[model samples]
Target: MILPEQFDQNELFVLTSLLIFYSLLFWLPNRFPLSLIILMMISSATVARLTDHLLSGSKMNLYSIMDLDKYELFDFFTYLLYAPFGYFLVYGYDKFKLQGISVLLYILVWALGATAFGEISLLFGVFKYKEWEASYSFTYYFIMISLMLLVYRFFKRSYKLHKVEIYNR
Candidate 1:
């Protein structure tokens, strides 16, 4: 997809910030289901589109294929787009049953896998980017993954400390 020539730094910042924020939300509360996160992502995207329309006074073009009407295909792909990765994250965490440092490594592996898949999708034109370089994809993913690891470690440590206090009681 061809991006607009005029760059809006504020909008770009908001989009990137939201993506990272949501990524961290998904990473936390390890027991939280992926479906919930996917739902939140969809809702957020819809709200973003609506906000764009209100700001631009025009409806956002969803997607198109060739000259024929093919919005459904686009919508379907978008809906299912993150399911596999989300599933993999949850499943991998459970299957490996990691704890402590192992959890951090598991999250890193999942993040790398997700980033590779995202790059592949972008390369094949399955999705498009705006105001983002190809290399930025890796960078963004790395940041989110590192943030997830940090947050997870913080919570895990807190829980352990709480458990110790309870045991002392």
Candidate 2:
């Protein structure tokens, strides 16, 4: 997309964070199948967009992304920002093999971390709020990450079943 006319915190945050996360995405070992990575990114970005619509849309109007109160080019890139994070979230979940109550604790830790990072984004001008608080995003992150973990498990089971079927065939 187009860069902002001026180099500011908003641009710096999105671009720099995107670069960092994408680097981590690639640098990290392949802990998941390619399909799962694709799924995580798609669902992560979609959930981000949809929730932004609900909270930031004309009706609720909780916050603004980037510079303006309106959606801008960087706003789209900001969604790109969420994709790699989703992969890492589930990647760590699987790597730990968290079970039972541990799953709940894992989601809680991720939600807290996401909320803290989001506050960093606020400091960097990635988000400006009118009626929203960083605390609220903790709930959003918790629910979304929990859903992603469920999706990962479902996909893992399906992949195993499909592989076994093909091998038997």
Candidate 3:
């Protein structure tokens, strides 16, 4: 078990490859079916666990927060919130309703909305995690939200192109 600090080149490569593979797989699949998306999510989670174990020599518990006891209820609720955000974005885009800068603004709004909701819930004692510092929180939200938006855009474009090709054929 390599600790997080002990990630060697091989482990790093494996993790990086898995990330890229999952991202591409999720991004290229048309329809954005919930079942397929869930499968991809599970695969990514499994890979994350494996990477943690390989680096730390122990099973990684998703329930464990960086600085809090397991808040199973809130954790589940948060996942619920996140799922809809992803679903709606893809749905809107696929329907050709959302486009250009509007789509981007929507993504940013949703990201900030989710972050605010999470922070408020934490403040209200619904969950226990360290409050994110302003800079770190912004950066984290930017990366996560951008990743999801990019994947959705990729899938949307691919689906459109595939549809065009099929019609032409």
The candidate maximizing lDDT is: 2
lDDT of 2 at 155: 77
Residues 15-100, candidate 1: write the lDDT tens digits.
Answer: 44346545765665444334433443454345433432342232433332112233333333333334333433543454456788
Error of model 3, residue 134, in angstroms: 4.9
lDDT of 1: 0.45
Q: How many clashing residue pairs, candidate 2?
A: 0
Q: Deviation in angstroms for 91 in model 1?
A: 1.0
* Colliding pairs, model 1: none
Q: What TM-score, computed on C-alpha atoms, does each candidate reach?
A: 0.42, 0.91, 0.48
RMSD in Å for all candidates? 12.2, 3.4, 12.4
Ranking by lDDT: 2, 3, 1
Encode model 3's per-residue lDDT on 1-169: one tens digit a residue: 1133333443343344346544654565355555535643543344433432343232433223212243333233333334434554454455555667987786677667656754654454433333334344455556666676576556546757766331110
How accurate locally, in lDDT, is each candidate? 0.45, 0.84, 0.47
The numbered model that scores best in TM-score is: 2
Q: Judged by lDDT against the true structure, how good is candidate 2?
A: 0.84
